[model samples]
Target: MVCVKNLSFRLQKIILNDITLSIEPKGQIIALLGPNGSGKTTLMNVLADLYQKYEGNVHDVGKVQLLPDYAYIPEDLTIRECFNLFGQVYDTFNIEKAIQIFSYLNLNQDQLISSYSKGMKEQLHLAFLLCHDVDTYLLDEPLAAVDPLTRDILIDLIMKFKTNSGVTIISTHLIQDMDKLFDEVIFMSNGKILLHNSVPQLFEKYPGLSLDDIYKEVNRNVPFN
Candidate 1:
């Protein structure tokens, strides 16, 4: 479960202002949506405990892990080495799960991380995070640098976590297929939440429009059909 009330953060200026929301304690996938500099990443960072000097209250139960947009391991280490290192650092890290993910993604564990492409690196980072036993995952741009096949695989893996009551908040600019991935959506602008609703509610309110269209409509502040 994750809850934020009257939260505001600043770094010389306001980044997130007077935001309040609560996420259910069960299986849920939340999409954090907005255009450039809209504070999506800032909100994720706050929830991840990366930034502490903020106003208002933030509360969550169980383990919370963050997957940053640029999360990377030591470049010189092989994939297996990275996993081994993670096991040493985190008691929650599971090698069996890690191996399964690597196999599913068709990643070669013996290869040096430096030799992998950007997409490959993204997959590795996801594998590392998904190997953890956590209640909440704050993933920033999990689909940023991957092909459609890899993206689909990642989505499948994420959805499986729902059965275990894991909550995932994904921040992304790429909204293609979001309708299939997000259980709920939060629209933000200029460091403030514009709207928050379940997918069914959103679709019912804006009939005959995809998520992409709905986002555009919301941003333009136009009446829904």
Candidate 2:
């Protein structure tokens, strides 16, 4: 279980407002639905203790691992070298596991990351992060840089990660395509939670509406300002 209660963050101005959330992981994947600059990154950062000056009580979480908005690997390093470096930093990093993941990408481990394309880098970054065995994964836009075909592959990876008895919160703008895959959906806007509901509950409430339609309806009733 992970809980954030009465959380408010400030950086020049209040970014997270008074937000609260609870997550129960164990083959559970939650969707953090929001648009660009909707406080998704800020909330995840606070949970990761990247920002300490925030007002909040974050509790009951263990082995929290965050995949930040930026890739942490060095551009000049080869894929194998990057894995070795991260393996040294994280005790949970499994070289064997990382190598197995790379088998899918067909990437040359000897080549520098600088030679990879944006989408390739993005996929590699995610693959690297999955090498760590952790309880919580904060994935900001996990599918941001991938093409349609690659997106399916990454989604499969994320699904497999769910069975690891960990909680995964994925922040993404591709809500329509991903909504049905989530156990629950959290609609966030302007630093506030507009709604939180299980996918089934959402369907029950909206009846025949699609996720995009539901989002529109929720936003219409809520004050995004």
Candidate 3:
């Protein structure tokens, strides 16, 4: 399990308050939902080990694979070279698997990432992350800028990951499309977790309401000030 105990972060005097969360092991899919500037990205960064100057602790008992919001794929490197570099760094790179994923995603091995479109870049980033084996998957806005068709493909890939591997934590504002895919929802506001419940439990508590509606209602009355 990945545990966040009283974790907090501050940026230029704007304090992101304390937060506590526990993510169960593999086979669980947690979707994080929040409005813009609500510290969703901040929390993801902290969990991904991108932000180390914060307070409190984020403890992961197993390997965690984090997919950041804007992963920088070197503009000069070819697709193949980038995969090779990542493999070397993680020491678990599989050239054949990488090739298979490229074929599945319809990505050209010779194409440079700098020349790919924004959506393509996002897809490549996800593919690269999946190339490694890990216990927890942390994805930040995996569906951003992706078309609906590609979104389905991405969702399929995630489902396969969970079936073959274990847990995945996806942070996104597009909850409506993902309601069926996630097992639970983690709602956040003002740098603090507001709700964490299974999809069915949340619906049962607030009948006849969509996740988006719940989000709007919560944020509308948030005591942020």
Identify the candidate with maximal TM-score.
Answer: 2
For model 1, residues 63-105, the per-residue Cα lDDT tens digits are 8788887756899999899888999999888888888878877
For candidate 3, the TM-score is: 0.88
Q: Write the per-residue lDDT of candidate 3 for residues 119-210, one digit (tens) a residue.
A: 77777888877776777778989898789887887887777644244678899978778778888888888788988888898888889998
Off by over 4 Å in 2: none
Worst 10 residues of 1 by lDDT: 157-166
Candidate 3: minimum summed lDDT over ten consecutive residues — where? 158-167
- Tens digits of lDDT, candidate 2, 6-116: 999877777898998887877678888876777999888887778888887998767767888787889999998888799889887878888877876677999999998
The RMSD (Cα, Å) of candidate 1 is: 3.0
TM-score of every prediction relative to native: 0.91, 0.92, 0.88
After superposition, the stretches of candidate 3 with alpha carbons farther than 4 Å from their true spots are 92-96, 162-165
- The positional error of residue 52 in candidate 3, measured at the CA in angstroms, is 1.8
Model 2 lDDT at residue 61:
68
Prediction 2 global C-alpha lDDT: 0.82
